[model samples]
Target: MIAFFLQGLAIGIVSLIPGVSGMTVAVALGIYRRLIDSTKNFTKHWQSSLDFLLPFWAGVAIGIGLAVRLVAYGLTTFPFPTAMLFIGLLAGSIPLLLKQYWLATVGRKQLDRPLQLLILVISFCVALILALIQLNSPLSGLSMTFPTLWALFSLGVLSSVAFLIPGFSGSLLIMLLGFYALLTTRLMGFMHDILTNSLYIDWNSFFFVITFISGFIIGFIIFSHFVMAVVINYGQLTFASAFGVLLAAPLAIIVCTKALANLQGSISVVLVMSALLFLVVGFMTTYVLGLYSTEFTREHPHQGS
Candidate 1:
C-alpha cells in the first residue's frame, strides 16, 4: 500500500510537467503492468485491487493538488531550471524501460525487429509533432460558460487518453485545447477560497471542476481497459511504440525550454548552472528510484497481487 502510494505520488508529480507522462514514470517504477492488470480485472480481484489502488488514488489526488501550485510557481519564477529537472527525470527512465524490454525477450530466437523499429519511428514522430504544435501555440484562459464546460470535459477525455499513452503529455493536450491556465487558476483559487472562506464558494467553477473530473474518470477506465487488451494481444509492439514515445519526451522538453527561454529573453550564467544542477539532481533521483524499483520487483514478484 505504501509502495503504491509513493509510486502514485511520483507519477502525479511527473504528470504535471508539460512533456512528461505519468505512465512513463509508472513503467519505470515497475508498476505499469500491475496497475493495468489490476484495473482491468478489478471485478475478479476486488479485495486485492482495492488494497493496491485505494492508496494510489489518494496519493495521486494529493500529489496533483500540491504539484499544481509548486509547478505553477516554478514555471513563472524559474522556468529553465524547472524544465531541465523534468527533462532529466524523463530521460533517466529510458534505460530501465529498455532493460525491461530486453529482459522480456531474452531467449527469443526470432524477433520482429523491423516492425518494432517502424512502430518506434511512428510513435516518436507523432509525439514530436504534438510537442512542436504545443511549442508554437500555447492556449490559455477560456471563459467558464456551459459550452466551455463541455469543451473542458471533452478536453479532459482527450487528455486522459494521452495520460494512458506512455510519453504523451496530458498537460500539453490541455494547453493545446486552451484550458490549461483556466483549469489551474480555478483549481488553485478554489482551494484557496475553501481554506480561507468556505462561505464564498464559486458554484460555477465547482461544477466545471466536477465535470472535468467526471470525464477524466470515465476516460481513464475506458482507456485502461483498451490499453490492457492491446497489451495482452500485442505486448511487444505496444511496448516498442511506448519506448519510442518515451525517448522523444526529453527532446520535447528541450524544445519547450528553448522556446520559453526565448520568450523570457536572455538567460544568465548563474541560472544556467542552477538549471544544470537541477537537471543532474533530477536524473540521479529517477535513476536511483528505478534501481530500487527493479530490485524490489525482483524480490517481491507478487507484490501488487
Candidate 2:
C-alpha cells in the first residue's frame, strides 16, 4: 500500500510536466487498466482495489497540492530556465513513447512509408499549433470570478477525463483551456494562505474545488467508457490518432521554447546544463520505476476479463 501510494505520488508529479501524462507512467507500469477498472467499479471492487487505489489517489492529491506551488513559482520567476528544463524532459521521452508504440503493434519495418509520413506531418502541424497557442496567449490573472471558476471547473473535468483515455493529455487540455497557470497559482495561493493563517478558509474557493472534483469523477467515468468502446471497436484509428498527438507534443514544446522571451545573461547556458541533468533523472526514474511495476504485474497477473 505504501509503495503504490508513493508510486502514485511520483506519477502525479510527472503529470504536472508538459508533454507528459500520469497515464503514460501508469501504462508503462502495467496497471493502467486495473486503475481505470477499479475506479470505474468502485462500489464493486472497493474493498479489494480501493484500499490500494485510494491511498495512491490521496498521495496524488497531496503531491499536486505541493507541486502546483513549486511549478508556478518557478515559471513566474524563472520562465526561460524552467521552459528549457521542460524541453529536455519532453525531448528525452519522445523516442521512448514512439518506439514503444511501434514495437508493441507494428515494427518499424512493417509500417507503410506513406502513412507514416502523413502521421509525421500531422504531428508536426499539431505541435506547432499548440506551441503557438501557449506562446501567444497572455497569462491570465488569478480571479475569484464566478465565470472564471466555471471555466476552471470545466477545464478540471476535461483534463481529468483525459487521464482515463490512454493517449489523451489532461495537461494539454488544461493548456487549451487557459487555466493551467491560473489553477496552479490560485491553488498555491489558497494553500499558502491557509498555512500562514493570512486568510480564513475561503468558502467560495472550497465550493469550486468540490464542484470541479465532482465533475472530474463524473467525467472520468463517462470518458473512460467512451475510450474503452473506441479501443475495442476501432483501435487502429484510435491508436493512429493518439500516436499522431504524442509525436506532435514534443514538437509543440520545442516550438513553445522559441516563443519564450529570451532572458538576460548567460543563464541560458546554465539552464541548458540543468535541464539536461533533469532529463536524465526523469528518464531514468521512469525507466526504473516502470521495470519494478512490470515485475510486480508479472507476479500478480490479472485474471480473465
Candidate of highest lDDT: 1
Give a tens-digit lDDT track for model 1, residues 1-305.
Answer: 89899878878877877656687677767787778778878999999999988998888887888899997787777877887887777667666555545544544333478988999999888778866775777554566687877887887788888888654668755654446667877888777777788778887678767888888888887888886445334555766877777777776665644536633667778888988898898888767766755632463232210
Instruction: Please list all clashing residue pairs in model 1, or write none if there are none.
Output: none
lDDT of 1 at 265: 64
* Number of backbone-clashing residue pairs for each candidate, in the order shown: 0, 0
Please give the CA lDDT of all the candidate structures: 0.72, 0.61
Whose TM-score is greatest here?
A: 1
- The TM-scores, one per candidate, come to 0.80, 0.78
